[model samples]
Target: MVSRGCCPAKIGELTLWWKGPLWLHKEDADWPKKKNIYCQADEALLEARTVSHVLSTVKYDLSIVEKYSSLLKLLRVIALCRRFMHNASKKERLSGALQAGEIDKAESSIIRLVQASSFTSEIQDLCKSSQVSPKSVLLRLRPFLDKNNLIRVSGRLGNASTLNESQQHPIILPAKGVFTKLIFIYWHDNLMHGGQQAVLSAVRQKYWPLNGRNIARHVVHRCVKCFKYRPAVVKPIMGDLPEARVRPAQAFKKTGVDFAGPFIIKSSLRRNALLNKAYACLFFALLLKQGT
Candidate 1:
């Protein structure tokens, strides 16, 4: 019988002993079964250690580490995540409305989503951080923001800040780079067969993407339908004169008459009375050959 820890001191020693001819001397018990049992135990120990390591990691708090970084970056990331979630939710809702063929409802829902994703307090904070410049789209909206003309409303994408006009309820655009493509696509679909001015007008009523007019014009210019159906305004070529006006004719073949005016004639009788009350001067012209 082999005593535990007697044949070998370390695991390596035991492995060498088992691999060598020394194992042949252990004929008292089944060495193969013991080897299988030992292997299983080692695997179980490794798995237990792995699980413990994972649980230890879960106990730590990562938020404290994130706090050391610039706050603006964190806020921007949070705002971006919020906007993404809001857009996804609204897209689902819009899809449902469109699937039901409720066009008005879909349009209203889209407008609501766009309004919801407008500029918010996070954007204002970002602007105040000096990260955005005067030439930036957000900075250009400073006038509206300062005048209190734009109102902020609670929304899924943080807070929505936009204009409150009846005819032009413009949504302060978010993620200009990404939403510009979306806006162009929407305008193209909505204003199918419409002109650039029409697309611009339609987009202005609901959205205020940067360079919106240029985007609309670009989409219009790229539309095959618009190019194929555009009306041409070329001046028509003048034709030759009619036979009646151009052909020669006999003298007096045609005549035109006109009355000149009423002329007064004085008589030799009474000085105050006229011989004839009035006489109308007459004139006539005849259509003839050049010599006649």
Candidate 2:
């Protein structure tokens, strides 16, 4: 029941000044004489409420390289991660080392990171006393860890003296991983948009991707350059109807229209005349016409 031009009223510790129509001033005080009892509730009369948390578990996505959409961009991120770790270990916020100098190491480190994420169970088994489980996909490849803890294919060529280490024991990669697909694309583009078999063979020289054939096929098929240069499929033209099997029809009822090319035409009869091009539209009855 406040009105304009009314006397000042005390509302708890606040006082509304009446010098103007609407003005409020809080009075300075050590303490309020009366406490607000409406806000206080009795502990015994209060209802008990239980709080429950709904925790949602999310499965980790393996295709992290797909997020960046390019292998080079992902490699730069890995290089940055390496720089961060290097700085952390040294306990300094300053620039530790040149990123370009360690980019090669970062490349290998990124490959290892992808391998770990894709094959957690295999890595764990290899790290522990037990070997990779019998049900593991890597069992068929005879996978063994290298000094850098990367899984590599163990083939009979390991005994060969002339072959290099990569050829003898190529790195193992999961076929479905984005990083592995990017590697396939890299090799495909690097080889001038090579065929599927060629790309697969080139990739196997350094890394043995599981289901490599399918992945290579997919990568080759998805290449824009390869698709652009790929020759158009020539459909076999239908054979013309034989005279004995020809159906009798009205002359203009079964008419077919076709287009003829731009023939060079003389604009004038003079020897040094300008040339022009002309096209012809041909219309013919289907029964009498032969397939071109």
Candidate 3:
């Protein structure tokens, strides 16, 4: 019997072994069973392993990653397994919220997981060194770890007494993250399908997503109601009038008539005579001078 160093990972009753770069599932089958079992990485192992270890374990060539048009999609795939593990491990920190049917808490947990996985490098740098690299995208945000270990914008609003924690130091999130997009969608819906600027403003109240404007624009753009109700673009110049409408014509050929108000009239110019109503009709002739 071949002995493995680490114990196999049990995920939702399924035992999976991570040998080298492949994930092998250990299942009971009718076929001959071998005493040798494969052991895989679990949530604990995943956290124990460093970035270099995980990177080394990846067997795919650069071509596979290059096939993806957007880097965000690639990042999502890499973080998928970790995300699943976190959700499954919800019993630790998020179990109560999940059991209580608190959707807001569950969403917050998911967001926290997203940040932990996506911004691992930045988080590590902030925790270990207390400073982010200049080359990092988060450099401009002046990011710092909050009480919850979540990265937040270290802006100049720290002294504002009226502003809340979220308002003074909003959570930092990647604009391209799926959860981030979902947040934008939530705000868009909550704001009664507002415009991009309005959604962005609402989002900034609690979270600050990188490239937030673009993300908000994308969310608003995808709203079917907004697209349907959007105003049509008006041309600056007027369209050319039809030849029949502008061409010169004979007098009264393209004429218009209007009637003036009724005037009281007297018969035989006598003040006591019977009064009659009379209306005067006026006619407008197009190209009247040319025809005359």
Clashes of each: 0, 0, 1
- Candidates in descending TM-score order: 2, 3, 1
Two-way lDDT contest, 1 vs 3, winner: 3
On the 0 to 100 scale, the lDDT of residue 52 in model 2 is: 97
What are the per-residue Cα lDDT tens digits for candidate 3 across 1-292?
1133353344334323333323233334633346644333342233243355344442323343345544344445545534457778786532221332343344454556767766777888998999998888999889998776778999999999999999999999876666677677778888999889999999999999999999998888888889889878988988986554578766577765678868988867776899889988876764452322
Instruction: Report the lDDT tens digits of candidate 1 across residue range 1-292.
Output: 0333243335454543356434344875746666444444332222222334343422323242234233233334444444556678786532221232333333333333443355444345544763345554465444233122332222233233453452333555544433444556556666665777887777666556667777777778887777778867799999985554456776555545455445557766676875555655433324342221
Best by TM-score: 2
Which portions of model 1 miss their true places by more than 4 Å?
A: 1-136, 143-169, 174-179, 188-192, 231-292
TM-score to native of every candidate shown? 0.33, 0.57, 0.52
CA lDDT, every prediction?
A: 0.48, 0.75, 0.69
Worst 10 residues of 1 by lDDT: 146-155
Evaluated at residue 215, the lDDT of candidate 2 is 96
Which candidate comes out best when scored by lDDT?
2
